[model samples]
Target: MRREVPLAITFITGFLLIIGFFIPHDPIGGLQSMFLQWYAIIAGFTMVLGLMTLTRIHTRRIVKRTQGFGYSVILIGAMLGTLVVGFYSGIKYKGLFELGTPFMWYYNNILVPLSATMFSLLAFFIASAAYRAFRARTIEATLLLIAGVLVMIGRVPVGNLIWNKLPIIAEWIMNIPQLAAKRGILIGVALGMIATSLRIILGIERTYLK
Candidate 1:
């Protein structure tokens, strides 16, 4: 009965939303707005649920004294501290959580530097991976290697000294090949989304319910 009720609600809601897109009338539009509000409320609850889940998992790890348990403790402490400070301080003035607040101080000093260091480490790892990948084994690999080298050089002032046409070639590769490939992937993704949405509406996609 529980499963059936949710499935029925999903089917009805999906069908109504599909219909509402075509018929932009009074009752359907009103229903869509109300549904969106309800969705926002549900989303808020989901965030709370996610935080609870995170706390539970970390607390269990701490209790078990598992490997990297100290990291878990630190994560839980940081999360709870951030939440308390954010709520207590109150974010006023549009994305700036109250000047001279504990939240703002923690965010600016601690969070920003930590995030920057993480990204810097990520760049180092990415460069190492790219070096491994760009070996001139095959024609395709050679072409990729050349393109990557040119792009890297072209972005700096030294490339102009090396060759006048390097920047132009780099720009052409990015604009033509890269942009075309990106568009092709986007089109495929859009088609897949449409297919998935249709399947969901038709009740052929039941994994979501599960």
Candidate 2:
């Protein structure tokens, strides 16, 4: 009964959401569009669940003096702080209009910088990883190495000056190999999703809610 109820709710909720996208005139559509605001209200009301869960887990760790418990404290503190600031922004801002003067400060400065830093980190990681992967090891590896370098160089002005053929190499990589591989992956993923969806619809899969 416990498991069944959650599964039923999930199934119904998902169908309604999907249908709402197709039927803009329906009440389901209206409700779906309004769901974000409704969610914030419900989330605010239900925050006690999160607080209790965090307290239960962390309190146990703190009591036991467990390893990395201090990090947990910092993590929880950051989460709570972000939630408080975001909520206050919504409230003090008053429904997407007229005055969130104070909260906008945090949004613009803190959130923007953090987002920029995250993106910069990802770019750095990609460059470093690509450098390590693309070496003249084997035939396939050499091709990958060559393709990646061409793409990287073609993206900027200096690359075109150094190797006039780099752009053409990048174009072939993008048009043929990369495109074919991406399509194959997308088809496989779609088939997997379809299979999983059918299993859920037919009650063949029951582990989803868990």
Candidate 3:
């Protein structure tokens, strides 16, 4: 009964959305907006569920004294601290996310800096991956290495001093071959998404029921 109900809902919702896309009339067209509002409400509950799940997992790790438990403690502490501040600010000032509110202050000062630091650390990993990829083992790798070096050099002022045409060549490489490859990838992704959506709509993709 549970599975059947959800599958029926999914089928009806997907069919209506498809209909609304093609035939934008009063009865069917309004269903899309109403469904989107329902989606937002459902998403809020799912977010709360996700937060509860995260806290539960981290609390278990801390209780078990697992490796890196200190990190879990810090994570839980920061999450709770942010949540409390956000709720308090929302009730007190009637705006949790206002520019000068405590929530935004925590977001701008603590969260943004932490995010920047994480990304800065990720640069070293990217450089390591690039080093392996740029090895001149094959013709394609050699071409890639050369193009990468040229692109890097052309982006700098020193490259202009060395050769004025370096930037022009770099621009050609990026605009011509790179852009074509990127567009092909995007088209492939769009096709894949359409296929997946169709599969779900047709009830062939029932993994979501699990």
- lDDT by residue (85-178, candidate 3, tens digit) is 9898898885878878888899899989999999999989988999878999999999999989888888898989999999988888899988
Model 2, residue 173: distance off in Å is 2.6
- lDDT, candidate 2, 1-210, per-residue tens: 888787776677667667788997758888777775777898987887887788789878877889999987876776777678777767767653235454576667877899999999999899889878888889999988877778888878887898887777788889999999999999999999989886776567888666
TM-scores of the candidates are 0.88, 0.68, 0.90
Return the lDDT, model 1, position 105.
97
In model 3, where do residues sit more than 4 Å from their true spots?
A: none
Lowest-lDDT window of 10 residues in candidate 3? Answer: 91-100
The alpha-carbon RMSD values of the candidates against the true structure, listed in the order shown, are: 2.3, 4.4, 1.9
Count of backbone clashes, every candidate in sequence = 0, 0, 0
Tens digits of per-residue lDDT, candidate 1, 96-157, equal 47778788998999999999998999988999999899999999999889989989998788
Error of 3 at 53 (Å): 1.0
On lDDT, the stronger of 2 and 3 is: 3
